[model samples]
Target: MTSDSMLREVHVRDAIGLVLAHDLTQILPGTFKGRLFKKGHIIREQDMERLLDIGKEHIYILSLEDGYIHEDEAAIRMAEALRGENLSLTETHEGKVSLISDIHGLVKVNREFVDAANAIEQVVVSTLLNNSVVQSKGAVVGTRVIPLVVKEQTVCQIEQLALQLKQQAEREAGPITVKPFLPMKVGLITTGSEVYNGRITDKFGPIVMDKITAFGSTVIEQRLAPDDRDQIVAEIQYFAELGVDMILLTGGMSVDPDDRTPGAIKQAGADIVSYGTPMLPGSMLLMAYLPVGDRRVPVLGLPGCVMHDPYTSFDVLLPRICAGETIERSDITAMGYGGLYRC
Candidate 1:
């Protein structure tokens, strides 16, 4: 049949045994709204009454030519082009396929690839923001083509583009991937004379521990230290000696004379990435890497706000750190744009 005659709209009574060209949706005000007949479904005799009740007097039937592709097939091909490691694809439904995470990790997307894909006519690939944290089975991306029957060449262009991009990057994976978090052994040090001297109960350790555990890591040991710079430095060295993957020092990060966490981190032979950030509630945060025997361990000097704030710079960087990323000054500086949390 010619392209113009590829799709035929027939009355519901005559549609029996014919395949549906696309999904048919039914809506009952505030009661229900969903697909009544999926794409490619062979219309049945029993479906006539229900189809008529949903006001489906006529429905289109697809007789695709060699050069044309159905939406379901197009969606599957598009998802294959976009699927990366640690991601799973859902069955195509209503011309769309969703990308789901197979593990709890950070979702990374190539924004340039997404932009280029969307630039192709009738093609759609939508994704969550790059570097988003997702749990197992969370949906991260959706892929589909706009039309019920797209020209096969259109879909091929997307596949070729993905191939070219991957080849150029010298990687085997596609534009989207989930990097799993590493279970790091952490050492925590609470630095404040008020808590170290037993004048007040320590709260920072518990909060820090909770955050670490949530990311599938544990605090190997928790140490208390007075505000003295040497004492704080000594605790940092001790954790380095223990070969902890990460060290977290909470409190005393401010510029106050008695607050010396930042200086102590530097004194302990760490390469400070950033001693401060532009993010509120975490402006005094410190990020560093301390050299061990063969590897460098991440050391963070968290500001006082971390003990109380629901989300701070610590929360921003911890996941990346746990994912085996080296925190950089650029990363710390970039947090400023979306960093304002308090009113």
Candidate 2:
């Protein structure tokens, strides 16, 4: 809380030791960073030159509106409403609270809940795509109050909306959460006569290997099979017998005459989750599950988009799979809303 009697405007040079009345942003070449100085930050003599360089001839040393919530306090309340497990909050700056991932995993944001919260006046919660794979210490979301000073009631309303969302979600972790990946042993089968022969080197194997390793998984068995349905099926069966949790079949997912990976999975008695996706460059993707006795093995058929597209349908679903999510047709269809991945 700030009182009107404490308001003061002071020159930059004379502002040393005075607390900043608001947040100050510091931007460098090719980057715009925030929180250079928070509202409650006490000015230091060393910051004087930097402040002058940023074109601050004078600054408001202490000026807070009456009957309104300060930006920092408002941001704190807003962040508290959305914080979940594996998420940590950074210091508030310019009325913004950056949400960072505490571990490398998949991020889940409840869209309906977020929309309802944002509908409240003076409240904003911006986040990355839902189910995005975020690295440890990466920035995932940001929460803030739009105005420098908002009516106290605005904060209360935003908090109430968040509470409602949490209740509706019925999860102890709330509407926003990160599902950590489980350790997995993945088997990869690359199918393409061109690569199986000596014609062209296989490119998809290394890419898939890197992705698996980054998610704390290992490629226990990798095999190259010609574009023959029986050979692909045989390879998948072999891996499943080896007790691999997941199998990836790449390079024969497209509609070309040589593309037999989908047929091979069907021949292997795998239950097809979805034959294709609505995502651009990845619409030919396939997902399936093979039941081996009491165990179920997830099988993914990757299209050529995996080799080129920076982010595709495979990227969208891999994290969920790694997090032990059983992705259904409806889940894949929901991704179509933001599935267009442009190079």
Highest-lDDT candidate:
1
* TM-score of each predicted structure versus truth: 0.91, 0.80
Query: What lDDT would each prediction earn against the true structure?
Result: 0.90, 0.84
Pick by TM-score: which candidate is best? 1
- Candidate 2 regions exceeding 4 Å error are 1-20, 23-67, 197-200
Against the true structure, candidate 1 has what lDDT? 0.90
lDDT, candidate 1, residue 299? 93
Q: Write the per-residue lDDT of candidate 2 for residues 64-156, one digit (tens) a residue.
A: 556676777888887777888899889876668988899998998888878887888768889877888889999888888766666778778
Residue 226 lDDT (model 1) = 97
Model 2 score (lDDT): 0.84
For candidate 2, the 10 contiguous residues with the lowest summed lDDT are 1-10
